[model samples]
Target: MIGTAKYLFGLSVGLIALLCFAAGAVIDRRPDVPRAPPPDAQEVRAALGFGQMALILMGTSSPVSFTLPQAWLDGVHSLVSHGKDNLAMDGRIDGRGAVFRVSKRLTRHGWLNLAFRLEETSAGGAPRLILYAGGWRAPEWLTAALLRMGLPLLGGSQELESLIPAFRAEDQTVQMTARVPRALVGGLQAVLGSGEGGGVDLELVRAIYGELLAGAVLEPEPDYARIVRRAAMQVDSAEGLKAALVALTMFTDGPRVLRLAGDRTKTPPCALTAFATRLHGRADTPKHWVLSAALTMFMDEKTGRAIGLWKELDDSLPGGSGFSFVDLAADMAGVRIGKAARDGTDIDKVIAGLRSGRPEIILPSAVLQLPEALPHHQWKRRYGPLEERRMMRQERLIGNLLDRSPLYSRLPPSRP
Candidate 1:
């Protein structure tokens, strides 16, 4: 009986061990590995061409990081060697890296300006690029170009939302900056949590931008004083204040608040009446208290305190580093204040000059220095380098077209 018992026990143990081994093997062979991107390899290769262009415009040292499959880099190389529709300044490959410039026609205005550098995976296992925001004027346009090339910003896609938590680093805050309304509170909370001395909550700032883009009509709570005090506590740092200015000035309607032409098609204005009104004199508020005041004036168009507030802001707010929020606001307000002869000519300047209550028919200036058209064949001879040559050629062509086209003549010239 004892011998029989021992044999049965030993057999049971052996069976259990075999079952464990089989289960381990099945798990090992499971198809659950992380994928790089869009299922089509060919598409990824095609995207490399555009990615290469974005890399040059943004730069190798940019704060924004991107990781692409090695295959994408290989494909970009193939295009550079053969593609004729490529940019005048074709991308150059360096060991495990690439650099290039990209230019695009801005209708009759001018070509889009950009340059960048790209590198293989960093220690974080993704390619990285640096954007000199100081020089980067049209971020939205640049972002669109990158998206066309299959490179979206981090935490930028809805399909990738579930995977976001896994991808986020320990210290990284949840980024909610998209044209989504649900993320506003979460973003606000993050910014407020940063406190007086903490780093600016960039993620939160992005959330605000998302709200603006969606043309959110924020209805303030009954306790206006409490909310305003809370906002003051949340955005105490200079960096935080700057972040607010950036988010606010880059209005959802477009770059500038005012419409260039008098179409009377206005975007539904952001509802800031309550918050701005309440925030007027809250203690320990942002140094640029006028920011809130300005918001109220923008939405209400009262101009009661707006004109005086503008003077104070224009005098106090420092300039000369990057795109100015003051300039953006001024344009939106349609208040032109340059030299007498140089009021309105280029569509951009005209857009800037158009202020609230100003007449729309400002004439083109007499000193209008339109670009000189040069023939394509003489591109290399007249322009010294690749960058200069391409820029000059495009400008000249645009200038000649402007001079000849009836559209240019229809535009009103500067008065007096």
Candidate 2:
């Protein structure tokens, strides 16, 4: 009887251990593990091609890092070499399927642009982005090209690098400014601007780039800002300057841009309203004050003083965001949907009659996302990367939009 009891206890303990392991498998969901992008293995090999040039390239920024283990280094080196070996500046990535020649249309912009190299996959297969080299500096010619052809800034200083575990030390906040050749940058710009067919952001990209990326303060240099802002205008083919002017009309007494735009066409008051509302203020609330303001604004904490939250700006504000900062407000011409669903209105069809724009779709898809018991932002600070922080902020912005819109209940909270 004693031996049987001991055996039973041992089995129970083992079962508990297995359950804990299973729970861990469920919870330890990192993006990289599941969303590992397919690399063009052959193209990777070509990118690494360097018969004679290999010796000279060593002294520069070593891709070698202590953080990156040895075996991995050998693998990546193999990949880079594959491209360098078989490929030339003009060679097609997968010559059999579709050749990815650098577009001449992009060349005029100069060197300070991310050279997006296209690699050929199997025949009829989608092209894969294999080479993320070049685009570190802009030459005089490239700058001139931008001026002449109107290619403005796209990537900011903060985004010069990204999360490359193999090349970086411990993964905190380090922008691995790729030390690619200035000429290489210029070459890429030429290819992209050449416009034969390089899939760069040909249109104005209104992405809200954040500064917390490098954990460093970006000195106020209006040159890049001006370039980017103007580029944003150029991409949409709508005058961003004019959009700014149109947005400024919101403050004026008469009907705003949305109101006037909605007058002739089926643009939603909210569609134009979002653009006008974006002009409200550059609402850069600090982290702590955001908490206080939330308690005040939503929780009805009279002392919360969300209005005062704007007053207490900490750390010079890492790119202020508001409820309605539409990076693409200029693009909101007409709605393209048939039936409206938000707050039970035909706003979708109304907007569709006006313009054909893709609507923003939001989803959580995580069980943890549903649980509001723990403060997510706080959790992110404790263990999240800068990207996670930005994601959380974006989630908050989406929530704010829903709360304001008549579409809160219409949005399905949970997805299968």
Candidate 3:
């Protein structure tokens, strides 16, 4: 009996070890880079199709891969972030990293089809792009912040609920109203409940949007889609921005192409800074792994996708970084932060170690001007003081370009 029991125990131990070896081998396999839909896969016959797709190169991760158009964009950028803010595409945020694909046979008579994908796979490798453009406004807090910082904003106040009375007509539920921009007078007249007091702000903001930003005042009230089409005609039409955000935006339903390249001489108005999005929440606080892991974003939803890469840290883990931020970037860089394989024992050390390399820090393209732009609320939301110092120091590298670009000439730019 003793001999038989020993044999069974030895057999069970061997089986367990074999299972573990198989699991380790599976994890060790490299991730497969996604390829475009096959040539015969109906996109070619259909009117809607992507012009190009290709695996670009590896970024901050060892196992993680980057992809873009086979051709390089004249304007390309790379940078890092500690995970804050929404990606500002035309006006649509590619929220939750869900796919923002578009198809527009634009028939205005019926109802607007709002397609929201709950599945994250749909928005793979794409930042959120605008679907319909021309309606989004800088929120009042942001406006006040920017205005206080010295932007040429027309006007706004902190009691934003009062400032934008568009939905207060009958004390209804969260009503979704779509304003047609071209028909300015008609749009204003259509204002439901807040009376004349609200009309002026709407008209003023719309007019400025169309004129100073959009560069063309609409003759008649046009639907949001139409407004986007009209604005797309200009080199810098404020309305043109919408097409940049959503994957399938329409200029009267045309497929606008975005090329990605590394050359720094030129830039796309819509291109974004590539920042590292860490999802362990604030490492400074303990007992935060679950709350941080389940984070839901309120504004600028694209941060959701950046976090999607790290959603596997189940709520029950005895949480903490097994590796420092820097070390994790090196060790897990290429590994998919899948459900079974996230949450480290030393995340704090990993972060510190990676940064400790002391990479020559740079600024996000949006607020590269530093302390001078620092005072502006628009600038502050995107960049803080520590980054501001980095930006200030780095400007010397692009001093000549800053001197020549019309964009910078408008700002103080000089060191404070």
RMSD of each: 23.0, 25.5, 29.2
Poorly placed runs, candidate 1 (over 4 Å): 1-373, 376-416
| Full candidate order by TM-score, most accurate first | 2, 1, 3
In candidate 1, what are the lDDT values of residues 1-416, reduced to their tens digit? Answer: 99999867755654554344323322221111112221122432344444654444333222333333444444443332222111112244555554444332223433333445444443423334432111333244333333332223233432322212112111111111112222232342232122121233445555544554443346433332333222323343334443333344333223232211111223423433222322223221221222332232222222212222223222222331222222222222222111111222243332222211111122122212332222223322443222245533543443333333232333331110
lDDT of each: 0.31, 0.25, 0.23
- Scored by lDDT, model 3 comes in at 0.23
User: What are the per-residue Cα lDDT tens digits for candidate 3 across 1-416?
Assistant: 99999867855655554344323322212211112221111212111111121121111111222222211110010100112221111101222322221111122322112222211223232221212212222233433443232222213222222221222111111111121222222222232111111111222222323332232232542223223233323223112222221111111121111221011123333333321122222222111111211121111112222232122111111242321222212111212111111222233332222222121111113222323312223232443222256433443434433334332233223221
Better of 1 and 3 by TM-score: 1
Question: Comparing 1 and 2 by TM-score, which wins?
Answer: 2
Off by over 4 Å in 3: 1-81, 85-237, 244-392, 396-400, 411-416
Highest lDDT: which candidate? 1
Cα distance off (Å), candidate 2, residue 94: 28
Model 2 regions more than 4 Å off: 1-34, 37-178, 186-377, 380-416
Model 1: how far residue 7 lies from native, Å: 53
Candidate with top TM-score is 2
Once model 2 is optimally superposed onto the true structure by TM-score, how far is the C-alpha of residue 152 displaced, in angstroms? 26
